[model samples]
Target: METLTNLESFVRSAESGSFSAAARRLALTPAAVSRNVAMLERNLGVRLFQRSTRKLTLTEAGESFLAAVGGNLESLQNAIAAVSADDGQPAGVLKISVAPSFGIGYLLPLLPEFLQRYPRVRPEWHFENRTVDLIAEGYDAAIGGGFELASGVVARTLAPLHVIAFASPAYLARHTLPADPSGLIDLDCIVMRSLSSGRIRTWNMRNAQGDEVIATMRETVVVNDPTAVREAARLGLGVAMLAVPDVLPELESGELVRVLPRWWADAGALSLYYPSRQLMPGKTRSFIDFVVEAFQREDYARRFAGSLG
Candidate 1:
């Protein structure tokens, strides 16, 4: 009989269409997933996947094998995982991805209490600006706005993603504050280059009464990251459009002030993305619940809203 590990590797590789992706889902290396698949193929005496540089395709026999075992395999694995979880504490390497500014500013502070409560769980965090493939990259969870919800994933919203124009008091002293979104074009504006699209990011600003305008500002400085943009604004380089969470500290400190207080952009919601609930491990579930509860208790949803500007 084929070992459950080998069968799982084969199935996940087939589903994800790559050993690397399967490795992430299985918490193993790509080589380990490949080796397991190879062993399974050797045992079955048939090739399961057509290997390639860019993509993996299932062979005829591989497709047949997958159809035969996929459903049963998942049911068995779920049963095994459920039993194991019931018997043990939530303990494992919990891998997550988030934006550096938000992770450090907000989520990092929550780490100590979380660790104290769940000492057996280890956190491996990746702080980056771009959206990651949760299944392909093997993240336990990701927190951010504007992620394309791929197959087998679900998102729980934590807060509104509200983009508002801001600038230092020094910069405001040199230039008149914009009366509306239209006047923003006259000011020196620091803009962000979208990491995924490699283009200047723009947003449509709206007021509570439903007045809408596209914020087309003259880019005096361009940056790819949110933190850098905030710093540039702090240095009196130019007015910058940033999320409320990104500028809350500066705003509170009287370093940064809102430009168009009534006008802001609705970018989307900052969300926590993960694989489906049924397939989630104990650690990931615990982390998700903890984060969601924390966000609620802190009322981050209201605090992060640009409409409050």
Candidate 2:
């Protein structure tokens, strides 16, 4: 008979996406997790993962195994939790999804502190701009900023960020700043295609007085990463809309200058979202608390209204 420990470790490795992360969650050595997985593979007589330096992707066998056993293990863990709520500290793998740009700019830097504080809580962070399927993909929680969400999930606000339009000082020095967004059509625009929307975004800028300008960007330098877009804008490529947190350093240093002082775009708020559950797991609750406390710090999310190109 297969041991529950073996099944537990296998499921954790699959959810965490690597042996090292799984081991961290289990408070075991990476080699130990590797051994557990290896033993299971040997017993089953098939390969489970196709691993590489770049990524750890699941094989068909691994996917099938995860699908078959993940929910059962989750149920078992939950039942144990309900019976022994106060018996122990929270422990388990926390799989979180975040956008690549925001993770790079803000969240990733704070992770070390979180790990140091919660020794029993191991986090497997996935930085991808793609939409997260909480149930299907086995993610415990997701940190995202968008106006919309899929059906049946619960979203909680993390922070509200304003949309600012900006461009580099170098670009403005060579090319006159567009006094109004209507002039943006004549200037270079850095186009970012949304992973979720599957369409190019051209936002309308509106002033506090209710005046509006629809900035239709026809000729744009394109990039997928928001960091790349910010870099391009910093290097004088074009004007771009960005979250205030991402461009704060530039704004403070005067490296990037805002356009159209009075008008601001309606950028959506940032949030942490997950699939609704009748019983939130201890791991999930701890993860949410850590994130909420981090971003709720007043200085962490403060941003001004202006042009960010």
Candidate 3:
């Protein structure tokens, strides 16, 4: 019989393509993972991987074995995790990925209360702007909008992602406030360049009555980040279009005011993403419930809606 650790090491090594990566995911040393795989090979009487200085490649035997066991590993792990949590307390490392601005501004505030409730769960948070593969990257959950739903992943929407035009009061003081998108042609416009695509982003804005208009503007400043766009607008550079959640604080504080307030573009829904598994880790389940409850209690869905503007 093969040990679960040996099977897990072989599977993770096969999936990640390197012992070091597998070690990181498994929270083991590279030597330990290598030894586990070696042990598994010794037990099975066949080499699973072709070793190399640059990359780890699976052998024909390894490929077949992976195909046989890959699908069942997750279920076995989840079952073990559920059983290990005998006290029904959510305890362990809760790994999460989130966008920097949104995570720092909103989610960070909830940490104190969350930690108080789940004292045994340690949070490992990665704040980055790109969409992460939740299962591949070993994240328990992720928070953001516009992520593609990959296999074995699911999304729970928290709020509407509405892009609306905004500028500092100082900037609007010097220029005419656009009555609509067309009036933005003569104004200096701060635009967002897509970080993934390397192209300037433009949206088609709509009103409550379903009136649509293209938000075509002169791109005076092109920034690749939401924070930069907000800051540029705050520095009175030009008008910027941003998601309501991104600039909610600025809007509430009068640091930035909405321009063409009646119009906004529906980008998508801000979502909580996680793996779609039959049995979830207790910590992941608890964190998801906490965030969803917080969002509901605070009425963020309505507050983050630009249509209400």
Candidate 4:
């Protein structure tokens, strides 16, 4: 019988398309992964991969082998983990990626409760604005708005990421508030430069009357992050377009007030994404359920919908 470690190395290398990538996911050296796969091929007496400098392509035998074992590898690992643990408790590191603003303003508050309930689970989270490769990078999950769906991953919507214009009371007191999207052309607007596109984003806004307009504001301050834009607006720098979830506390505390209240930009849905598998890790499953329950309990979808009063 082939050793489980060798089988794991072979399967991961095949799935990731390169031994180096598989090594990263498995926390092993590239040489070690390659050796294990080489040993496996020697034992089986069949060449599984067509090796090339650019990419690793699976041979017919390798494809057949993967089809036979790939579907069951996760189940086998979960079974081993359950039998090895003391009580099958959800105990492990849960790595996640989230946007800085949402992570600080919303998810941070719920961490204490999650930790209290699952004492054995530790969270390793990254606050980033860009989308990450969940499987390649070995992330358990991620939270963000409008990420493209990757293979073997699924997303669950938590809330609508709606953005509206906001300005500090002091700034509005001195400058005239915009009555509509067109009026924004005369105001000093704080805008965010898209990191992926390398361009200043244009605002696509809609009113209650179903009229939509694409407005380009006079940029006074250009930033790369939403948090910086919110801070600039709060400092009375200029008007900013921000998500309701990011500015909810400031809006409630009277630090910032809504401008052009009738109009908001429909960005997309904020979602929690994870690898779609038949047998998920205990820690990952627990975190997913806990977060979903938390969102439902808070009624976050409607509360942060960015609708005007």
Which of the two, 3 or 4, has more TM-score? 3
- Backbone steric clashes in candidate 4, count: 0
Runs with alpha carbons beyond 4 Å of true place in candidate 4: 1-6, 27-71, 78-88
What are the per-residue Cα lDDT tens digits for candidate 3 across 213-273?
A: 8989898998899999999999999999999999999999999999998999999999999
TM-score of each: 0.89, 0.71, 0.91, 0.84
Please give the RMSD to the true structure for each candidate, in Å: 2.5, 6.7, 2.4, 3.4
Model 1 residue pairs with clashes: none
Rank candidates, lDDT, best first.
3, 1, 4, 2
Clash count, one per candidate: 0, 8, 0, 0
Candidate 2 wrong stretches, greater than 4 Å: 1-75, 82-88, 147-152, 196-198, 304-309
Better of 3 and 4 by lDDT: 3
lDDT of each: 0.90, 0.75, 0.91, 0.87
In model 1, which regions exceed 4 Å deviation? 41-64
Kindly list the per-residue Cα lDDT of model 4 for residues 2-87, writing each as its tens digit.
98888899899998899999987765689999999999999999999999989999999999999998877888887866543436
* TM match of model 1 to true structure: 0.89
lDDT of 1 by residue, 95-154 (tens): 999999999999999999999988889999989887988877778899998889998889
Q: Which stretches of candidate 3 lie over 4 Å from their true place?
A: 1-3, 20-32, 39-46, 59-72, 84-86
Kindly list the per-residue Cα lDDT of model 2 for residues 1-309, writing each as its tens digit. Answer: 676777877888888888777776665687888888888888999888887876677899889988998888867766765543354466677788898877877788887887786667777888987776665456778887662466657889766666667888878787876777888788888878876676787778788777888877655788766788789898888888777767777888999888766667777767889766656766777678877787667455454334323
lDDT at position 143, candidate 3? 98
Best by TM-score: 3
